[model samples]
Target: MMYTQEQNREVEKVMKAFADYIRDTQHFDLLWSDKVGYVFLDGISEEHDDFCMAPIILRDGETLCEEIIYHIACDVMEEKGKSHDLRLCGPVEREEIQKRLLPYLRQLPEYEHLVEGLFEK
Candidate 1:
């Protein structure tokens, strides 16, 4: 879960790029969908299912989509760790840690990469 300053910056850059892409290209309110298992860059309605409304922005201007995606990516990476203590920490702790690390992770350039990977088959 510990990330370097450089990695932090990378996450931020990627997040910003993603937000910009959504704003300029997609032009719809992007939100996270747990059903589809990735962030969707479009508006939602009452009919949508299995989706969680996400915060769109942080005080520092980072997007929530990027933060969530980064957190998921980190979770995926950490899942591979061969330590009982780490595995025992569980998804709850992973989510909590992601929330706590939002500020630093928002600054990472890999944010976009993580998001992009979400849609890759």
Candidate 2:
């Protein structure tokens, strides 16, 4: 997850572009953590079950759009329990997410292409 100055800057550019894409097609208030390089969007409605919310994670020296979509899938699912169970276990860890949720998300035809097109070079 460690990146050089140039790498981080590049990621910021890609994420901002991604956010702009989300803004165009969806209604969300985006908040970003440059520290962790994740995009957080608020104001999601439960009525929109078809919506896919994923984090934008920069992997290795390149940004694969699929990985970003997978992270967002994980992000949305992790928060789902709050509405369903009404229990606050704690914040979900990135490692835990990648370990458990990512495998399932990779197969889903959800945000894969949407994010890929958004970050086209």
Candidate 3:
């Protein structure tokens, strides 16, 4: 769904806040996707924008495309923790945990209302 101007502003605020938090605490740089639910971390070289959001990458087609595109803040705490540790040390696992955290991050209270307001049908 296309976002209204007010919704866009709210989402931008949330994105900026979340991005700042990630940068400050986790030190991972975030790049947002034009698609609603996708954001990528810097230094991870991936050609396609589709793979940018880790959780969406891990999801099955329908769920990934539908759920992630709407709610992008569900797993902030857990993803942030993992990303922070990964940034400080190194790659701990072969699989990207951040992608798996996308849905959860979108579920966050701070973001849930925004998603509902902006994307809910």
The alpha-carbon deviation from the true structure for residue 6 of candidate 2, after best TM-score superposition, in angstroms, is: 1.9
Ranking of predictions according to TM-score = 2, 3, 1
Tens digits of per-residue lDDT for model 1 on 49-105?
A: 433444342323234444445444444446556232333445665555455445544
The whole-model lDDT of each prediction reads: 0.44, 0.44, 0.37
Q: Judged by TM-score, which candidate is best?
A: 2
Q: Provide the lDDT at 47 for model 2.
A: 69
Q: What lDDT, from 0 to 1, does candidate 2 have?
A: 0.44
TM-score of each: 0.23, 0.30, 0.27
Minimum summed lDDT over a 10-residue window in model 2 is located at 81-90
Q: Score candidate 1 by TM-score against the native.
A: 0.23
Winner on lDDT between 2 and 3 is: 2
Q: Model 1, stretches more than 4 Å misplaced? A: 1-12, 16-50, 61-66, 73-121
Tens-place lDDT per residue, model 3, 1-121, is 4445655565454444455344453222444456653343433334433333343221122222233323233233344453322223223321233344444456443533333332223
Model 1: worst 10 consecutive residues (lDDT sum): 54-63
